[model samples]
Target: MKRPIRVLVAKVGLDGHDRGAKVIATSLRDAGMEVIYTGLRQTPEMVVNTALQEDVDAIGISILSGAHMTVFPKVMELMKQKELTDVLVTGGGIIPEADIKKLQEIGVGELFPPGTAMKDIVSYIEEWVAENRNF
Candidate 1:
């Protein structure tokens, strides 16, 4: 049997509201991916380190702290620094459309917004990992 995709879902920075992150985690778990949630107030370095240590295929960061610009880019920069280009970085929450596009251009796989159907997020990650997990 194929092993399910392993994802490290984390809440970064001062994002205190975790209701959405928890929801995504549960949805992904139900979709058969092994999810490791790092709870709240995590730094970009910590999230990347945990992803490497856990050997997860993807990193899903849920941030509502309005720090996605800093946090997401920082995570990507550190991932490059740690030679971790293989891990997929995707996330959502209170992010404007313009920033989302910019993030995607810089290699953030995808961005989900409020009311994005959970099934779509699940499918997106599953298909992406299935194709990108060549690592």
Candidate 2:
């Protein structure tokens, strides 16, 4: 049988707040997905490296430091460098809609903003992984 879907939920940069990340991790776990949460103050490289090490199907970054532009692009670049093409690079926080569009254009997956439903996040990850990851 195939192993459970694995997701890496992370808090990047100086975002000391992590309640959302923890909640998502727990919810994903409860939803039957294996979740690895890289706690607060993570760099893009660190987050990507941990995702690689864990062999996760998806990477969920929780950033609220107004660094979405820098964080998402840097992580995307590193993911490409590591050839983690199949891994979903997604995130959520206080990001503007225009910025979300830009990030999506550059290959970042669906980004959730504050107040997005947990069920939506879970379904999005599950659908993306089922279609993309070779699990």
Candidate 3:
């Protein structure tokens, strides 16, 4: 049997609010995906390292401290350095639309904003894994 989709949901860089990250982790678990939540105040390096160690299919960052610009790019860079090319780096928070576009331009995947439906997030990850990950 194929392994379940594995995702590392993280809160990077002093983001003390963890309710959303926990919610996403639980929701993904309920959707039959394995979720590893790294809790609060993680660095980009730490998150990527954990993703590598966990062999996760994706990294879902929950940022509400207005550090999307720095966090996403740093994670992307680390992923590149670690040759985690097949892993999806996607996330959600209070990010502006323009910043989302910019992040996407840098190879970050679809980023949901606040209030995005849980089903949508689940579906996106499912489809992405189906298409991108070689099971």
Candidate 4:
């Protein structure tokens, strides 16, 4: 049998809020993906290292601390340095449209804003894994 899609859901930096991360983790689990959630106040290094260790197909960052700019790029750089080329790096939070475009330009995947449906998030991750991960 094929292994289930694995995702690492993380809250990077000084963001102590994690309710949304928990909700997304549970929703992804219900959608049949294996989820590993790294709890609050994690650094970019910690998140990426954990992703590498967990061998996740995707990394979902929940950043409400307005550090999306710093956090996403740092994670992307680390992912690159660690040779995680196929791992989808996606996230959601209070990021602005321009910032989202900037992040996507730097290789971050589709980012959902607040109020995005859970089904969409699940499907996006599934589709990304299907297209990118070799399984």
Residue-by-residue lDDT tens digits, candidate 4, 68-110: 9999999999999999899999999899999999999999999
Better of 2 and 4 by lDDT: 4
Backbone collisions counted per model: 0, 0, 0, 0
RMSD of 2: 0.7
User: Candidate 1: which pairs clash?
Assistant: none
Tens digits of per-residue lDDT, candidate 1, 34-120, equal 999999899998999999999999999998878998988899999999999878899989999999988887889889988999999
- State how far residue 85 of model 3 sits from its true place (Å): 0.3
Select the stronger candidate by lDDT from 2 and 3: 3
**TM-score of each candidate?**
0.96, 0.98, 0.99, 0.98
lDDT of 3 by residue, 1-135 (tens): 999999999999988999999999999999999999998999999999999899999999999999999999999998899899999999999999999999999999999988999999999999999999998
* Backbone clashes (count) for model 1: 0
lDDT values for all models: 0.91, 0.92, 0.95, 0.94
TM-score (C-alpha) between model 1 and the true structure: 0.96
Superior by TM-score: candidate 1 or candidate 3: 3
| Candidate 2 residue-wise lDDT, 1-135, digit = tens | 988999999998998999989988999999999999888898999998999899999999998889999999999999999998999989899999999999999999999988999999999999999899786
What global local distance difference test value does model 2 have? 0.92
Task: List the lowest-lDDT window of 10 residues for candidate 4.
Answer: 11-20
Which order, best to worst by TM-score? 3, 4, 2, 1
List ranges where model 1 is wrong by over 4 Å.
Answer: none
